[model samples]
Target: MNIKLIAIGKTDNKDLENLTNIYQSRLGFYINFSIEIIPDIKNVKKLSEEQQKQKEGLLILSKLSATDAVILLDENGKQFDSVGFSSYLQKYMNSGIKQLVFVIGGPYGFSPEMYTKANGKLSLSKMTFSHQMIRLFFIEQLYRGFTILRNEPYHHR
Candidate 1:
């Protein structure tokens, strides 16, 4: 199955970009993984928190196809160990998904619609992380998960 990471906004730090690229290349050996960045919404200053989430949710929903299974990366979502995450990936692939999409929502988090539409929600950590930093962390963990699945040396238990 193809795995796609959809996040709102771009990472401006060159160091982080370099790391993200490194892991993306490593992940290519295991899965067809790609990152799609949604442009930041205009006039964010005038919108309330709820309104902002709604607007962002619309843009996010637009990227999804009827056949895609979407998973939201939410703070209150399920937490998985490395091996368990690999198994999770195994399950999805076994289920014969065409494209499995995971989204890292905007600052205010997902709206009601986005939450309801999601097939699952995953949490990397309980603490708050910068949206940009989460992109790096999740992609690295994805690479680590695939490596662990393949019994590669990149991940140590």
Candidate 2:
């Protein structure tokens, strides 16, 4: 199965973008991986938090295909160890899913509509992380999961 990461706004920080790209490339060796960046809403300063989430929700929903399985990265979701996460991915692939879509929501988090649309939620850690850092963390974890699945030396217990 292919994997896609959807996020709002571009990572303007050069260091973060480069690191994310490196993981993206490493991921390509194991699966068809892609990252889609939804442009930031114009003049967001004038919009309230709820309004921004609603707008971002519409854009996030638009990127999804009918068959895609969406997994949202949320703080309140179930937490798993590295081995558990790899097993989770294996289950999805074994289930013959076409695309596994992971979304990292914007500043104020996801809207109600987004919550309704998600297939499941995953929490990377108990600690809260900035959205930018989450992107980097998620990508690296994805890469590490694949390596672990293949019994590569890159990942260890």
Candidate 3:
């Protein structure tokens, strides 16, 4: 199965983008992987929190294909260890899924419509993180998860 990460806005920090690129390249060796960036909304200062989320949610939903399985990176979502995450990925591959889409929402988080559309939700940590930082963290963990699955030396218990 292919994996796709969809996140709101671009990472402005050069260091973070570079590090994320490294993991993205490493991931390509194991499977089909891609990151799609949804442009940040314009005139954000004019919109209410709910309006912003609603707008972002519409954009997020538009990127999804009918067959894609979406998993939101939500603060309240399920948390799993590295090995368990690998197993989770394995299950999807075994099931013959076409694409697994994981989304990192905007500043105020996802709207109700987004929550309803998601197949499941995953939490990287109980603590909050910047949306841009989460991209790097998630990609690295994904790389680590694949390494664990393949018995590579990159990951250890």
Candidate 4:
């Protein structure tokens, strides 16, 4: 199955972008991994938190197809260790799904409608992280997950 990471905005930090790219390239060897960035909402200063989430939700939903299985990377979602996450990926690969989409929402978080559309929710951590930083962290976790699945030496017990 293919894996897609859909985040709401771009990363301006060059370091973060480069680091994310490193993991992105490594992920390409194991899965069809792609990062789709939905541009940040213009006039965000004029909009309320809820409005921003609503607008971002529309954009996120627009990128999805009916067949894609969406999983939101939410702060309150289920937490898993590296091994468990690898197992999760293994289960999806075994299920014959076409695409596994993971979304990192905007600054304020996901709208109620977006939450409704999600098939599952996964938490990278309980502590808050910048929207941009999460992209890099998630990509690295994905790389680690795949390596663990392949019985590689990347992940340590």
The backbone clash count of each candidate, in order, is: 0, 0, 0, 0
After superposition, the stretches of candidate 3 with alpha carbons farther than 4 Å from their true spots are none
- Model 2 per-residue lDDT at 60: 97
Q: Higher TM-score: candidate 2 or 4?
A: 4
Model 2: how large is the Cα RMSD against the reference? 1.2
What lDDT tens digits, residue by residue, belong to model 4 across residues 83-144? 99999889888988899999999989999999999999999999998988999999999999
Candidate 4 stretches with Cα past 4 Å from truth are: none
Give per-residue CA lDDT, model 1, range 4-51, as digits (tens).
999999999999999999988988999999999999999999999999
Poorest 10 consecutive residues of model 2 by lDDT?
148-157
**TM agreement with the true structure for every prediction:** 0.97, 0.96, 0.97, 0.97
Could you give candidate 2's per-residue lDDT for residues 1-157 as a string of tens digits?
8999999888878999899999999999999999998998999999999999999999999999989999999888888888789999999999998999999999898999999999999999999887878899999999988998999988864
lDDT of 3 by residue, 62-152 (tens): 9999899999999999999999999988888898789999999999999999999899999999999999899999999999989999999
Report RMSD (Å) for each prediction in the order shown.
1.0, 1.2, 1.0, 1.0
Tell me model 3's lDDT, rounded to 2 decimals.
0.95
Report lDDT (CA) for all predictions: 0.93, 0.92, 0.95, 0.93
lDDT of 3 at 140: 96
